[model samples]
Target: MTGKMLRGMVITLVLAGGLAACANDPSITDTIDTRSAPDGMKTVGVCYNGNNTTRAAVSEIALKACPKGTTKLKLWDKDHMANACPLTKVNRVVFLCLH
Candidate 1:
């Protein structure tokens, strides 16, 4: 391959990597509801630092720990938990973000 073509590919790869890194970085803001599904369903909200991959892993753990037929689990918020998912024994709960 030509030098110019190789350089272009390298630059593209670098830029793509940087963009992905930026995308993975989570932003924190207080919200009323953190559940991916905002419904009457019992929802557990944890403090998500925008790490979707880790969050999914954590969620896998939660699902095993939680009771059957429970779906709503998310990054935690104290008030939301008290009000929303209190009756949700099946609601998988976790706080303190993990990398």
Candidate 2:
């Protein structure tokens, strides 16, 4: 392969890697549900790495978001396809934050 072509390929790979790293950041993955929340309460969602995992990781994220207090309402998979707690594979925790 030509030197210039090889360099271009390396640059493309590096840029792709950077983008992938940014996309996987947990902070960016978390979401908040304010649209459906009742007055004085907000819903916080956090993602975990493993499926069917404990609440510890997500709980920490919720607590950080709430600061005052929070109540875990439900847990679901990454897609929010099912209502399951202690999530199964790519856990996304939903918590009710009191405001």
Candidate 3:
């Protein structure tokens, strides 16, 4: 191939690679919020990365939020929006742990 054609191809390849990297970037943010608990219920918030967050992983975090002897009443995400437990691979997982 001519030098000009080769240069153009290289630039195209580089741009494509950059776009792909951005598309697959894992911009996950996990957090825990305990400010919304009811009068008697203790609540905690947890966030996990979407690429590796699993139900088991979330449960483990929730189990740690509450005291050992306390009863776990519910485990949900942000205002009980998600009904599923051990949530899917999401960009942000905001779990509310209640005891």
Who wins the TM-score comparison?
2
lDDT of 3: 0.50
lDDT per residue as tens, model 2, 70-93: 544443224453423223234455
Give the total clashing residue pairs for model 1.
6
- How does model 1 score by TM-score? 0.35
On lDDT, the leading prediction is 2
| Evaluation by lDDT, superior candidate among 1 and 2 | 2
Per-model TM values vs. the true structure: 0.35, 0.47, 0.41
Give the range of the ten consecutive residues with the poorest summed lDDT in model 3. 83-92
In model 3, the clashing pairs are 30-47, 30-48, 31-47, 32-45, 32-46, 33-45, 55-86
Q: How accurate locally is residue 15 in candidate 2, as Cα lDDT from 0 to 100?
A: 100
Q: Evaluate all candidate structures by whole-model CA lDDT and list the values in order.
A: 0.44, 0.53, 0.50
Worst 10 residues of 1 by lDDT: 83-92
Give per-model CA RMSD: 12.4, 6.7, 8.2
Stretches of candidate 3 off by over 4 Å are 1-35, 79-99
lDDT of 3 by residue, 39-93 (tens): 5554545544446546676666666765566555364444333422233323333
Flag regions of model 2 displaced more than 4 Å.
27-39, 48-64, 67-90
Q: Relative to the unseen true structure, what is the Cα RMSD of model 3?
A: 8.2
